[model samples]
Target chain A: MKLRPSSLFLGLAFLICGCTEVTQIGTSVGVASGTITQGQAQSIKRSAAAVEKTFQDITPEQEYYIGRSVAATILTTYKPFDQEAATRYVNLIGQTLGQASGRPETFGGYHFAIMDTDEINAFAAPGGLILISRGLLRCCRNEDALAAVLAHEVSHVERQHGLKAIKAGRLTNAALVVGTEVAKNLTTQELAEATKAFEGTINDIFSTLVNSGYSRSTEFEADATAVNTLRRVGYNPEGLVDMLQEMQKRLKPGSHGFGSTHPAPKDRIDAVRKILGKPVSIVDQPVRKQRFAAALSKI
Target chain B: MMRKWLVVLGLLLVPSAVALAVNARMIVQVQRGQIRATPSYLASVLATVPYGVSVEILQTKGEWMQVKSLQGQVGWMHKSALTTKAVPMSSGSTTAKTGATSDELALAGKGFNSDIEREFKAKNKNLNFAAVDRMERIKISPAEMQVFLQTGAVKPLEGGVQ
Candidate 1:
């Protein structure tokens, strides 16, 4: 008789769901007396495996693991900025905006780092590992503008745009291989297959982050969320437009970084302007500007 | 035989009946998170829990769950930080069907974890795990976060849904 892994998982779910001790007694008694037929037990187990077929079903710990790899892959291209103070300042701004975002807390918590590069771009890996570039920082005219950038990245993480990049067929295949008997150590062959799936998942996200960029709709959603976050955090919502305008002047056609990875700045500016209702004057906050300048000094 | 079957039936039904009730133990899936005094991120932290630690759920309000740690400390944690699935702390144990979820087992350093990352890193030697570790090490405490916000005059709404 072929023992199905899903059937065993069904019993496991039952065991955890029942008062652990009582469920153990029940399962043992049912099996010993043959009161529950093998077919019924197998059917029960099959349904348990179905629960893990989607990206939404990917556990928080799983997302963290994927995020760690994605961040590692990104770091290979851009060295981390060695300035501690600058990194801390960006983290503070990112964390504050994250708190106001829909998902204030993620599995690994929100972490912000600066890549020591002249490339004007940012990447939000899954599970809140956000990396921004020094070139992008230089484009921010003030602290509010910086918050706008970080908030946009935080929105991407909050909405799980990175995970969405994973192809559906890949996730389904992974779920099948891993969900079956994942409760035990995988055999050598299974481990290889699971690792391959992991690599594919990572590549899907990395490619979207670096090569293709998020779909235009996804970028717009992040912008809209960032605007709301800025308002809730008491930063000027117009800072986003200001940042975009600055990028418009600096971004060269066919440039490598944001110029290649993102939608045209003019289009993004127009989208944000609709939300802000015609270009509004941005009030200068000196304290914010002074602190921003202080943080940027080493760069 | 009839009485034995009745008991078996009752035992089988117990899990489904109590699954939604209070006292369900949940695992902490996040690397580390604080249990706050209130159901808000800005609330005073009552305790901290590391990954794979199980906490007893006492109540839930919106996205916040009030949980009691093994140390007997009671506090609130965001739902995103907790998982209903069992989290395996170690590997090499093949005790199957003991109610451990597949996702739980996957996270036990066997699936898409440090073990797999080690394999991946070996294959792709160009990737930088060291920088990833440095990125993970960057942390900001709640007090420091509050101070930073105050310095910049970025005041979040009072009692706003965080």
Candidate 2:
């Protein structure tokens, strides 16, 4: 489905044209359709796909290096678990889930930990680093709920969603293709240009990237991955929905989510319901809830 | 005549202003030893500041260098402590040139050495964004101080967020 972007988005189309009279007329004529017109968005998709594919073509070593950088930045912004037991326990759950993921033995495994807060928030950096908030912990009545969040985040990393979003939402390549191996054979000068391109895309649409967030398709992909993961681990997929419904109730009328970053939770929750329409079979119990709660209590 | 003047001016300014663009495999000799602050350090470490790691030679204030790291982590170190080579290796790569530049940058440190190592690794490339975002949010909401506690790695190093 095409995204019906905010007026702020159409205004950006105006920015692409030269600031001549024609530019003014073109921008005025452009409108925010619920979806992109075939002409309007075809180029965007092609450019986004090319850039995204190019960005990931760098050596795996580079991926690890960049991951480390992003992870370090996260640590600066968020505190790690001070308590050794809690830290170790969170890591254990995370690693177990990581092992269960389709790609078990990544060069770097997933790292999850308890954030010392009461906010119902969780974040997964571009790498495997995942942060589960203390506030969010209170809402997770079962391990299924917790696993659901982590699995969704894991899918994001494996699928390279951030890389795709960063490439797609904002990037202006030259009319020329520098080379097929743009990312791989980048010289220092080329690297500088590439980094500038990287920064430009982020600077232009970081708000939309952060606010409007991932496309509904990516969210659905993550959700589907979460369900598959739950089944593999013997957890009921229904717990994901239960947790999401609770999120719906807990969120203030106007203030949804941690923010309007993800697709609406109610819509997601409904999708989950429709998928598991009858939820008839016996599924894994929320046995880990008490242990999870007890483990979190110390923080 | 205008072209002649511009060429002369560019040549004169560019050399002395020597970009010292952290060229790969360029060895720089350190003149002294001194404590340098690192983002990768939560608890201060008594490290042997190497000559090799000093990417930029800002100036000699007495027997030390006010050097800058690739990520903009700047600190003063005594000339006696650095080797004037590249940054000291927690391990350094004695490999080929050109591409070794990328390798050397990669060797900054692993989290295994210190929690700060992990922090540096986690926040690389996006350091400026993360820093600006966190700093601005903290300043705006004093009551939201609790959020900082969640995000911070440790208590203030030298009193403030600097």
Candidate 3:
């Protein structure tokens, strides 16, 4: 049967839209479960393979175009690093992290930047561009927490979420972003409803990405990917676990703050613990707290 | 006698080289689909060849095709994007797209912001072969200047490339 996007069984549907036909491949990976029929699972793999092929040969010039168009809009909306020293230092650090990470020569090189504002946000755009809001950096107890944020953002890029959104026409243009920021333009009644929708666990920005906010399971997948990424790079994988625990302490019953966009912190922490079930509780290289403190002292 | 012939030959070549001509640049529009360079599938973003800056072409693909950069890495963007634009590097002028006149000197110049309208006025004033010599230094090619000169009043020059 031709895989129809309408056949998606929840979370798997979100990952691979039911757009193609799949012939059954007989067996299933544990991840496929009841959510995916064998044919659906085959379609998902084919779709992922096709997407990889489509992205593999993008030119440096095309990368520049997407980077240029989005970078300008994002820069205009978000404050860039105010301190030149910190900006350059963070970029250098990002370069180092990128080299340490497996995919060194991405379409264009990866650039790290600190957004000038105090919003606890970090996002990765399609072309290896990472932006961490000052507020998020402030919340991190150490460099490892910062690494967790960076690693999470990296997973988003590696998974090509933005391109998929574009392919699906979920994002028509930057207008969707600009529209989100200008709440005053919304009628008072409209604003009230939006606030209600955004309150507590649902992240407004992510909720707006797709009609449904990213599922809890996708968050788990990303967290799993993040730990593996940090471990492969020789950074302590447990830093993500620690960061999740820290965020969990701050998350009140109804604090939608990060959860609205990210997963529930305590739930994620539990998930991480489950993944790391072993005698090894600490990462050999825990966050170098002193160096991180010294580096971020001025920010 | 050989030295005399060399001087005479040099004298002949110099005049033809200096013959009246103008120039222009081409900026590609991957304005859609995040333009990429592919002989087959995706549209390739035309960078200035030296230092790549993300540029949006003000006009759709122009034939004269002078790709200018804000950083000033100015050069001719060869239509080398397709099989048709593929020419041996040394074969004739790179800017001369097919059906270009031999007398036409392809311009590797960009008309910044609002220069397009003025360039057309310049081209129209010199359409007469005799007046073309005076218009040489301003150097905006006919393509960059075309729309402005195109009015119903001006009749087509009989028997030439459009």
Best-performing candidate as measured by DockQ: 1
User: What is the lDDT, from 0 to 100, of the residue A45 in candidate 2?
Assistant: 41
Best model per lDDT = 1
lDDT per prediction? 0.78, 0.48, 0.43
lDDT of 1: 0.78
TM-score order of candidates, top first: 1, 2, 3
How far out, in Å, is residue A189 in model 2? 4.1
- In TM-score terms, candidate 1 sits at 0.78
**Which parts of model 2 are misplaced by more than 4 Å?**
A1-53, A56-59, A74-81, A168-191, A194-209, A280-290, B1-162
List, residue by residue over A1-299, the lDDT tens digit for candidate 1: 87555456556766676543444444455566676776654544444444346677666667888998999999998888979889888988898788667787777788888998888989999999999999899889888899999999999998999999998777644554445243456677756777888899999999999998989999999999999988877788888989999998988888877988899999999999889997667666677778888888777
Please identify model 3 stretches exceeding 4 Å from their true place: A1-64, A167-213, A251-257, A279-287, B1-162
Which 10 successive residues of model 1 chain A have the least lDDT summed?
A43-52
Candidate 2 per-residue lDDT over residues A1-299, each given as its tens digit: 65445455545665765434333343334423434455664455445434443444422223333444444444555554456555554554455455445533232346666666655666655545566666666666565676677777777766766556554423335111222212133344544444444344333333333345677888888788877655554456777787787776765554523546666678888787777788643343343545566566665
List, residue by residue over A217-245, the lDDT tens digit for candidate 3.
76687678777665644455676777777
Relative to the unseen true structure, what is the C-alpha lDDT of residue A273 in candidate 1, on a scale of 0 to 100?
89
Best by TM-score: 1
